[model samples]
Target: MATFGVLVFPGSNCDHDAYHALKHVMNSEVKFLWHKDTDLSGIDFLIVPGGFSYGDYLRSGAIARFSPVMQEVVRFAEKGGPVMGICNGFQILLEAGLIPGAMMHNEKLQFVCKNVYIRTESTDSIYTSGLEKGQILDIPVSHGEGNYFIEQDGLKSLQDNDQILFRYCNEQGELTEEANFNGSVDHIAGIVNKQRNVLGMMPHPERAMEKLLGSEDGKPIFESILNSLSVA
Candidate 1:
């Protein structure tokens, strides 16, 4: 069975949610890796779940970037291991330099807590292998700083390399300004590293795993990881 690890920081409220989503829903062996630990042995995949890590004092994930566990996460990603960051986790990844770009406050400068649709832009990575291009997923986003920003060259690079994973879209999969929950550059909701081993997204797929939660679109995201491991 594939082993999954969820990194837990001091204020990580969504750690349990991610653990349940992977352990119960995906039937994978999951454990919480505290931020203080540097060891990453036996873990096949790692996740940084959404939460107000370190109280989001200086910045969303500024303090958490220096945590001991992040050192191992960086090494893991450098070796091509799969790493995923969701919401605040995405902030951490950006702060830690695992992925490009930075997150800013929502365009409306208010917290957004609701279901939003994201269209898959690529299926070349493990996170989206089970999904098809242009497939729309209804996922939940609860954060104040989810707007993604990057320089023009970086944006062009991501586009040219097909590193973008998901983009905010409407119910009909149309990219529109009204559909953009956050004013992210190019409406980017998720992106993978150049190596495609690390992914950072603002949406919380774990929160959308159950039908009772209003959508099962998130299931494919987790299943895709398992499928990639199985094929390996």
Candidate 2:
């Protein structure tokens, strides 16, 4: 059976959400892997779940990036395996070099938690394969240090490589400056690397998996991943 490895950091609080999202929602076998373990030879996909890893000190995801499992995540991503990092996981991916840029404190210096719409720019990556370019999704965003920052050249490269995946938007599903959740470069809410298998985003898609709470768009992201892996 195909299995996804979910990395657990010391303070990872969203590992269970990832498991639920992938297993109950996406219908895939999942293995909870410790951060100290570096070997990930058999997992079909890798996920770094969100939470306040390492107490969010030094910087969000800063200390957790040095965890042994990140080495494996990096290796897995390098060889074309799919990986995703949500919220704090996104921060770790950047620090581990699996993705680019760094997340700093929100410009408002506050932790904002609410449902936000995302404007999709790529539907070809493993994470967003079922989405349409320019499509809009309503997902929840919850964090204080999700301000994505990168050098100008890196930002340009992201654009050139089609790495920019999603951007925050308003309730009307329109891209507006007021809806830029954090001060991310070019209003980026998520990104994929050049290989397109690795994806990182600040929004908590797992939180939006149920229609009982008024949203289920996140279901497609995980579904697309499962389909891609099962087919591959």
Candidate 3:
């Protein structure tokens, strides 16, 4: 079985959700490691789950980036290991300097929670392999600061590199301005690192793993990573 490590930080509310979703849906061995731990060898992949780390005190993920575990996460990413962040996890990745751009407060200045429709923009990522290009997936989102921001040149570089893996859209799967939950630039909802292994997105794919939760689109994402690891 593929060994997956989920980082656990103080105030992380989504660790169990991610553990259950990945363990059950992927049938993979999921281990929870404290944010203060250093070594991460033997783990095939890493996931930074969502929640208010450090009570989100000094910025969403600012303090957590300094955690002992993140040092290893940064090293792992440099070694080509697949890493991912979701919701607050995304903020951490930004603060960790794992991916380009930064997450800021919602342009509307309100916490948005709903089933967001995101179209798969790229499948080159290890996490989006099961998704077809242009396919629409309904994922639930709950966060206050998810507005993905980047300078114009940086945005162009990301687009030119195909780093954008998913884009927010409407019910018809049409990219619209209003459907942009956090006013992310260019409607980008998800993105991967230059190596295409590190992924960050605002939508909670774990939360959508069960029908009882109002959606099941999250399964494919976890499956994608697991499948990739299986093949590896």
Residue 195 lDDT, candidate 3, scale 0-100: 89
The sequence of per-residue lDDT tens digits that candidate 3 reaches over residues 155-215 is 9999999999989999899988889968899998889989888999999999998888689
TM-score winner: 1
After TM-score superposition, the amount by which residue 71's alpha carbon in candidate 2 deviates from its true location, in angstroms, is 1.4
Error of 2 at 21 (Å): 1.1
Sorted on TM-score, best first, the list reads: 1, 3, 2
Error of 3 at 170 (Å): 0.4
Model 3 quality (TM-score)? 0.97
* lDDT accuracy of residue 57 in candidate 2: 87
Instruction: Mark the regions of model 3 whose C-alpha exceeds 4 Å error after superposition.
Output: none
lDDT by residue for model 1 (1-232), tens: 8899999999998999999998888788998999999889999999999999999989999999999999999999999999999999999999999999999999999999999999999999999999999999999999999999999999999999999999999999999999987899999999999999999999999998899878988999999999998887
Best lDDT among the predictions, by candidate number:
1
Ten-residue stretch with the least lDDT total in model 1: 208-217
Please, what is the whole-model Cα lDDT of each candidate in the order they appear?
0.95, 0.87, 0.90
TM per prediction: 0.99, 0.96, 0.97
